[model samples]
Target: MNSFFHDENVALYRKLIAENESNPSRDEDRHAMLLTLLAEETAKAKQLPRLPDAW
Candidate 1:
């Protein structure tokens, strides 16, 4: 994979850690935003196509 893809994934991972550490549940808005982000990520993962010839 290219550096850009790897960078983006790393950035997303950092953001998730930050979000969790910040205790978003204390604030309704932040909690909702986190949920939205998680839902979007889940949807994107589900949309990825499977390879034609996997081992």
Candidate 2:
């Protein structure tokens, strides 16, 4: 289970994605949303307990 994602956030992203899918104009919206989600995941990962193995 992903602790970082809440109900509200999921709903909001779903709405955004649905909107972009319904209308194929202005391709930046999907890219921007994806980047935002990635950044959010990075932020959440930073808060986790550190381990020996790393990049």
Candidate 3:
């Protein structure tokens, strides 16, 4: 529940959003990046044991 983790997640989420928005046609590169970000977030969430209250 720290600002650092919150900021990091927000940044990642923003990147995903930007990537998606930049390519509304579902480009392969965009999809792959989104999936990679999702997987990374999932792994981080799982490894954290407990998610931040703010998240």
Candidate 4:
């Protein structure tokens, strides 16, 4: 694998933290966003080709 392919996931982690926030004041919105993000990630993963064991 190349280093370029392992770019930092700063945006992804930030979104995950924001979605997982439990301030009670935004529970509904947060849960909805979480579900949307989960679906998006799943779709993206499904579209990628499988890698060999060496990876």
TM-score of each: 0.46, 0.46, 0.47, 0.49
Give lDDT for model 3.
Answer: 0.68
Compared with the true structure, the alpha-carbon lDDT of candidate 4 equals 0.55
lDDT of 2 by residue, 1-55 (tens): 2434543455566677667667757488565876587567666756766545554
Q: List the residue pairs that clash in candidate 2.
A: none
Report the candidate with higher lDDT, 2 versus 4. Answer: 2
RMSD of each: 5.5, 7.4, 4.6, 5.2
Give the lDDT of residue 23 in candidate 1. 78
> How should the candidates be ordered by lDDT, best one leading?
3, 2, 1, 4
lDDT of 3 by residue, 1-55 (tens): 5445745875787777677778758677766777777677656765655655774
For candidate 1, give the lDDT: 0.60
**Of 1 and 4, the candidate ranking higher by TM-score:** 4
- Cα-based lDDT at residue 45, candidate 2: 58
Put down candidate 1 lDDT per residue, 1-55, tens digits, no spaces: 3434544655685586577668745666665676676566655655666444555
Return the clash pairs for model 1, or none.
none
- TM-score of candidate 1 versus the correct structure, residues matched by position: 0.46
Candidate 3 lands at a TM-score of: 0.47
Cα lDDT computed for each candidate against the true fold: 0.60, 0.61, 0.68, 0.55
Give the top-scoring candidate (lDDT).
Answer: 3
Over 4 Å off, model 1:
1-25, 51-55
lDDT of 4 at 39: 65
